[model samples]
Target: MAPTPDEQSRTRTLEGVLWMLGSGLSFVAVNGIVRHLGTELPAAQGAFIRFAFGVLFLLPMLVQLLRRGLPAGTLGLFGLRGAVHTAAVICWFYAMARIPVAEVTAIGYLNPVLVTLGAALFFGERLAFRRIAAILVALVGALIVLRPGLRDLAPGHLAQLGAAAFFAGSYLFARRLSDLAGAGAIVGMLSLSVTIGLLPFALLVWVPVGPVPLAWLALVAAFATLGHYCMTRAFASAPLAVTQPVTFLQLVWATLLGALVFSEGVDPFVLLGGAVIIGAISFITWRESVLRRQRSSAVIQNG
Candidate 1:
């Protein structure tokens, strides 16, 4: 029997949650590799190589696009997204190099909150009171996690913060592109464009990479590509509001990885702050989803 709309929604949310869990695991693995590789590779080079090697995985997508001509002007948008995404990824690699995996993961959780503000500021979206209050809660959480005065700010922390912002920008563009392209196309553009964007910079400061490090970066690219594919599946299965909250699992996974693999001590404050931020974001997502459903029902009634 065909499921009712409510049942379908519930099923979709469940699928999204599972896909997000997969994405979290994939990203955690990537972070672990990036942390290890950071000791040997420059952040720029790691990022560039990740994308460059990632292109090999995305080859089928490239071939598909070539076989069927791309829509006019899409390449430019892809290029722009690639440039912005590369900046974020470089910062991420740098942060992973300097900070504990858990710390970087904690700071990274602020992406959705940043994306909300960016939408309001850059895209002129209306911000409701509840969303504004939720955002403030997230800000407080970020401060708690960072504890700027309590601990001297590390350059890696600052870089991770920038990474979160640029990641938000990349996400916004990816969301826009999703409307016009398939998941393969979006990922292909990102991999190809980011490689192109970083090539010149990589060429200037390039260092010889040993075989072991090269293999590590290849694994990073592989996991990252899988992570993105999972993310795309999650987003397609359910609304972002439903899936974004599940991504908080990355912090937990990162903390475990840091403790078990790197012998890094876990900070309670980071976990607490991440919890608060995730809680607030979850509420905001629920609120927005409710509003959307209500508006849809109202339109149905009026029609």
Candidate 2:
């Protein structure tokens, strides 16, 4: 016999939490691998190999898509997203190689802030006062993370900031594509497009290293693939408000892994700044959820 409704809901909630945890852990693993390969390989080369391996891992899904037939339209938007994401990956990989893992992770939280700003500018999404406050708080957190006056700014930090903006654009385009394309199609197309876009740059900067770099590149691919899979599962099962908090666990995981695996020392400021950023993100997510619920309830009542 099938599970009761209560049991079904409980099962889904458990599964969603597990998926979010797995996603967090997988991304931490990816960061660890990137940090390990940081000085050993060129960032562009690492980015190329990572996406190349990601494409290979998604081959089965591509085959399945081929079997089902491709989506008829949206190739233009797909290409645009792929290009934006390609740039983001390059910048992100460079920052990973150049900066402390924890700092890069902390600065990455700016993407959500960018997303809110992007929505208002591009999609005409309303900018409520609470969201504006969250954005301001997040900006302060970013400044704390950067500490521009206290420490000399590095190119990697700027690269990471640029990458965050690119990622925000990618997310906006992705939301559009999601309506017309299946998940597999969107993912597969992204992998293929990014791989193609990165190839020339990878070739230009290519250095021949032996098997160690290859192994690290392979780990990057594996962890990222697993992270994306878990993220997809988590979103499918739960609201963003429920699953988003779990992602902040990545900062802790990154700090610990940086210390234990790479012998990188944790900065106290990074921890403090990351906490603020995470808190801001949690508030933004909660507010978005409340607004969504209110809108939905209004619709139901009106209908």
lDDT leader: 1
Per-prediction TM-score: 0.92, 0.93
Cα lDDT for residue 86, model 2?
89
lDDT per residue for candidate 1 within 115-207, as digits (tens), equals 999889877989999999999999999999999889999999999999999999998888778778887788777878899988887788799
| Tens-digit per-residue lDDT, 1-303, candidate 2 | 999999998788788889999998999888888887776777778888889888888899888877887677788998899899989999999999888888889999889889989989999999989989988998888888899899998999999999999999999998889899987798898998999999998899899878878887898888888898899899899878788877778888888988888788988888788778878888999998898899999999999
Q: For candidate 1, list the clashing residue pairs, or say none.
A: none
The Cα RMSD in angstroms, rounded to one decimal, for candidate 1 relative to the true structure is 2.2
- Report the C-alpha displacement of residue 268, candidate 2, in angstroms: 1.9
| C-alpha RMSD in Å of predicted model 2 compared with the true structure | 2.1
